[model samples]
Target: MAGNTEPLSPRAKLAVTAGKAAAAVSRAAGRGSGSVIGGRVALKLDPDLLARVAAHLDVVLVSATNGKTTTTRLIAEALRAAGPVVSNALGANMPAGITSALAGGSDARYGVIEVDEKYLAGVARDVDPKAIALLNLSRDQLDRAAETRMLAEKWREGLAGSKALIVANCDDPLIAWAASSSANVVWVAAGQEWKDDAWSCPSCGGVLQRRDDDWGCGDCGFRRPTPQWALSGDYVLDPHGAAWPIRLQLPGRANKSNATMSAAVAAAFGVAPQIGLERMWDVTAVAGRYDVVSFDNRDLRLLLAKNPAGWLETFSLIDPAPAPVVLSVNARGADGTDTSWLWDVDYTRLTGHPLFVVGDRKLDLAVRLEVAGQSFRVCENLDEAVAAAPAGRIEVIANYTAFQDLRRRVGN
Candidate 1:
């Protein structure tokens, strides 16, 4: 079914039908995936469609440089305890994708949306979301997103007059700065695993100093805000200092931090922290992230690594067994046209592991691996590469579009 059908004019109905048809045609022609074409077409026909649909809904928005999709998925899954939730779970996070999700799932009372870092402000202004979850910011899609500080300023300006409760990560300086303008804020010490993107203070351009666990800019007097909600040793600490263990199917400390943020956002909406954390424990995968698929008799644990921060986190998830590692990179629109960011990652961590580089940018990755003193073999065919790997369970790490393609290929 296509969203809530209760309050649509005949003209709007036609527009929706036309948009769905366009999406069908795109899928049939193999020209597009998910709601991208349909959403774009719908928005083209009626420019104000998203704002209209979002008006009646209680929306919780999640945005960050990384983990937007996974965090959004976690929040949506947690909120489903309240009621049916509408969301763009396919990792389509732009304006067009948001429109499609809202229009299609219009009947739902609650919406959980993952927004791109650059587009969060405008989308938040239009949707008037009830709660905004501000996760850590990092350098991603540099060619298109310009600078991280620029986006932070945009967020600060965008939320200046908003009435929504802001759930922000206190660990990230950029996110802390961005959410500072909000009148109502809930700080969460969702651990910042990657600090390379936030070395300088956004306020006074001072060098940010790292203490034992927190960061502070001595020159600017910008220090890490004491969080009302914090994660400590597999447990979430409340303002009262009571701790609750978070058990999730997703691996890594990153997912644990994501769960903590979701728990805080859920608490903002009157949902119990226990309910949120329990529900998040059931989320085994987001999009293709943290999913193990059987491809050509080889088990492929797919991890989506779009940028350096993501790569660093996902690299740790790889099992150090002799199982072959498959890396697929594509310079397609979704994966960012510039492949130079590949060099920024610490691929030296992948030193001893056997690597199979594949995708449009296979040569680029192969060269990077070689430069890192890592030996890798080039294989264009994914199925062939997986079949060739000497393993029972192999790891396949891919960037945006390449991950999507591999997911479908592996029968997801």
Candidate 2:
């Protein structure tokens, strides 16, 4: 019932009511949260429901290959300092789920939406947000999602004349190229650890020249832009050259980078960097991610990594060697039908750790690890994997469906 005070047209009102009822039914049936189903029904009832519901709110759209969900949560937390904020706290970034979230929070003063990489342009068009946060992009869901450059080009074409202030990561060449067409952009130096997908310039098909953190193309003038905001170690440097410490409950540098981007977006909405960071400190986990579940007297920390780029970032978050690691992979529709991305991850980095593989695509993962010259045990299920590990803290990394399955099994 939390929605715009202004009266919606009869059709719109009915659509919203129907969506809510459907969502309630879905939850009652114990299927899922019903965000997607509810939104789909609402859209079928009214095609323009998203724009109508979000019309009164100051919306912020967040899009990235990875970290969009976490970044959206962080931005929402920061925005709450200003007023009532609504967000898709879950990892639902597609149009249907996003529409459901907005409709549910129609009365909120702010809307922080996490958008799927491929749907960013369409969602941005509908929301007409006050700001758009462009995080780093890399290869993901090869069969389902577009290639990195194709996605970047879509972003460029989609965001061509938007009035929203673009908060972009200049450290990523694709991101730089995508946001370059925007008239208003606040570039941030959030580092990109996965460099494989971005070696070639998106603007011109030339090898990107790299020198430390700087990158440029000799064939084309496209280069890394000077960022007004930059992350250096544990601190975020603001546009005024003032250093603000990034203290968060989240683990790893990728999260720090996510925090930096969130703070930048929050700043665009008139919240101070310190206030945003302080608010974000309360978030220990996102959508069951980084959740530590106790199983068989062993502490299993859950981490989700769906692609090569995601796995690259996740490796750094794992507890050091000697602590057994559980890797789960699934090639379900949500995780893409292809498991070839498994080869791109450098399993050798886990050389000193005991490794266990589980899931529908465990064989693919095992093969990749074998080729990497890393020894691992293939487990039939998550319980077996956890039981096989020596009782202590263990790391559990999984793809989309696999992570959800393990989370459910662990009662998370």
Top model by TM-score, which number? 2
Clashing pairs in 2: none
lDDT of 2 by residue, 356-388 (tens): 999998998898998999989999998898878
Q: Candidate 2: misplaced stretches above 4 Å?
A: 1-5
On the 0 to 100 scale, the lDDT of residue 6 in model 1 is 53
> Per-candidate TM vs. native?
0.95, 0.98
Query: Candidate 1 lDDT, tens digit per residue, 1-412?
Result: 1223358766666767878888789889977564888888888888877787787788988998888888998899889989889998887789988888887876687889999888888998888889999998887776788588988999999988988899999999999999999899999999888888789999999999998778999997998888999989799998888888999999998888898999999887777888888888778988768888776766789999989999999987899857679999999887789999998999888877778888999999989998999888899769778766775588899998898888778878
Model number with the top lDDT = 2
Q: What stretches of model 1 exceed 4 Å from their correct place? A: 1-6, 30-34
Each prediction's Cα lDDT score? 0.86, 0.91
Model 1: lDDT to the true structure: 0.86
RMSD of each: 2.5, 1.8
